[model samples]
Target: MNKTVSLDEIPYSPDSCERFEALRELPGAAFLDSSYPHSSSGRYDIMCAQPVACPEQPALAATETAWQQYFDELRRFHKDYYGTVQPASQDIPFCGGLLGALGYDGGNSLNQVSGAPPATRNSGGHLAAYNWAVVQDHLLQRAVMVAQPSMREADRNDVLSRLRSQRRVKHTEFQLGGKFESNFTESEYRSAFESVQSYIHAGDCYQVNLAQRFNAPFTGDPWTAYRQLRRTASAPFSAYLSFENNDVMMSLSPERFLSLHGNHVQTVPIKGTRPRYRDSGADRLAVEELKRSSKDRAENLMIVDLLRNDLGRSCIPGSIHVDALFEVQSFPTVHHLVSTISGELSPDRSAYELLRDSFPGGSITGAPKRRAMEIIAELEPDSREIYCGSVMYISADGRMDSNIAIRSLLCTDNDIRCWGGGGIVADSQWRQEYQETFDKVGKFLSVLEEMS
Candidate 1:
């Protein structure tokens, strides 16, 4: 059953980084900060820590049916609170959503995308798990501690007191090892780019997002690294998730895969990118260039069309439509052409059903999504566990929100793995596409070097 305990609002400064550090003492924490707070309804910044309940190490299912069953059970645990409270007439409350990372391999359960299985990877032993915890909403200036109905008042008070008494975090020195290693060499990536082109020419698929992974041995605090990443790339959909076995997922994603408010569902897909120039004049020119680029516009439009169809599977027929199109949004390192699409959920559909129809967001996959995923599985070597998948939350009221896990990192005890790539289209230049990957990951690499 849904249960909320009002707690004393902790003394928090508006500095997101410092606030995050203060809350780091909690185990199995999840922090989400929005870069563009003006775009959201007030509750954009949140920190959920100290899971009241979670799996020890949950394994990812191999099919959608299994995933569906898993989520159903998860939701059933907190159903009373899922969509029980609405802050406003049209707004969904900051109640609850599953907090975890969905790996790229999770796609297998959704559709028949053939590819090599992910390397025998070591990511805290579980692909995905959800948790319920004490959530602090920065915008609301309040903290809501969620617990099982049977939890004792003394135990609840102890959790609240700990959150209220968090100390300032100390800075730690991180050791950076040798140069980062890539799964694919430059020549190999070029060859793959050319191969994708060949497929496009053959009309196999319209577009596909191909990416490469980078890894480096490291010993330090992952939370510090996440703070540095956020400083460098303050994206609207940034998140940090810590698992039970000490594995952490850090994301500074600029794209939203999907969001649900009441019966209204929305998604904003980002398809085009251009590196931001240091000079103000040059930056303006770059933005203008991206705005007028036919290739970039066409690429974005195709994904827009694809997402409309994806939503159609779960939305009322006449309720789906594009809310915005071809709008260029600038970030610290790049400018992106993003489009927003919204629809009314069909009465029979649930959030899990919505995810079933739109897993591994179309923006990351190519047009004719299933076929492009098949090609992606054929070409990419490692399983995209978490990368290009999503960090999501589904509320009992059927409200949900998720981020395309780009500009993300998976941190284990000994090493950090990062991935970067872009869409390959018929007119995509091989050299540009190659550079785009670096442009996307440049901040991540730079922050690691600084911390090292």
Candidate 2:
């Protein structure tokens, strides 16, 4: 059963960002913000909290069996409660189901094909069973609180009452204690770039993405910082997730890893990039430059080909193709060359199966995904953790959506961390490639640093 409570009944303004205020302190909270400007259609913001159950995390999955078993449980749990339930409407992306970030390392544990370094942490990955979510539809200029049949009447009413109140609670102000320190200096990054080039020249992989981590001490809740970043650089696939163990993630990702609506699936991989400029002419030039760069096009094609192969595992034969290529999209901080590839999901396959077959998106890994993984593991010093992973959701009606965890930040143990990197190809210069990493995340770091 699906219960839809209109935004009017919540007593807050139709466009108030505080509509979901009740979920602020709730455990297992997750917000998928579409931030679709101009009040347009084609996107919806979904948020939920207080998961009924979640897998053991930070050490839960030690092997492939453990990984499959947990997901299997989620399938059964959702099926039992939401099998007959559906999204309130076609545009709603989620309607009470599994919602959480699938840390990048989650795939490292589940993937038997990666001959590269095995999952180093031995403890990562989590998915939560959510019974309710507030869906904000910008197109309709309306919102709905959809609750699952599995939830008790008392619980649902309690949630409704809280929403109607629209009570505001004071939160600790978030501040960076100091400037973020990088794990790699210029010389260190150059060394990694050279190694990746050697791998490309040796035919180990076509291109490998290497990254550097930056961290600084911080105090207060990450929610404040997330809001600040969103105000400046909010993306179509942005998300904020707060979990136990002081684990919090704020992702302002512009890359769509995968999305499924019934049998149709699509992926938009971002490849080339150039920073935005304040001058109108300079900005236009940057976009034009990204559009015509041959080296960037070549790099983009390698990942496109890699992803087409990945989708082949579960997509119907003869149904996969590149719908669009070399399209340039301008964001607040940069212009990116993105390409769309889509396929029809095989009738025999489910959404999670498709996800399993194509985890750790190929765009992040290089061509010949296995060898690229090994190269990446050998080059980057620390584990990627959630970066390059995904913020994903599987709905009761089988709708699915996820984002590549680039331009992401994490708060754990008073340490605030974020990563920046890009695909490195044979012709890529070490200096430009190194700077690209910062260009990807530099603005985000500035937002946090300003809070100090």
Best of the candidates, lDDT: 2
User: For residues 85-200, could you state the per-residue lDDT of candidate 2 as single tens digits?
Assistant: 64567866787788887777776656643433334331256578888888877766677778776677887777787777746767679988899999899999999899999888
lDDT of 1 by residue, 1-452 (tens): 33342334455445555556655766666776674333242255656555455333234444556665655555455454343533321232444445666776767556665454553343212323222344445565544544433445775676666666657567876666866788889999999899999999998889989999998988888877877777777788888877656888888898999888778899999999989888999999999999999999999999999999999999999999899999989888889999999999999877767876788799998989888888877888777777888887764344578888899998876778899989888999988998999989977887797777
Give the clashing residue pairs of candidate 2, or none.
58-123, 59-123
Q: Where does model 2 exceed 4 Å of error? A: 1-16, 36-42, 54-61, 65-70, 113-123
Q: Roughly what TM-score does model 1 have, to 2 decimal places?
A: 0.89
User: Going through the candidates in order, what is the number of backbone clashes in each?
Assistant: 5, 2
lDDT of each structure? 0.73, 0.80
TM-score, per-candidate, Cα-based = 0.89, 0.93
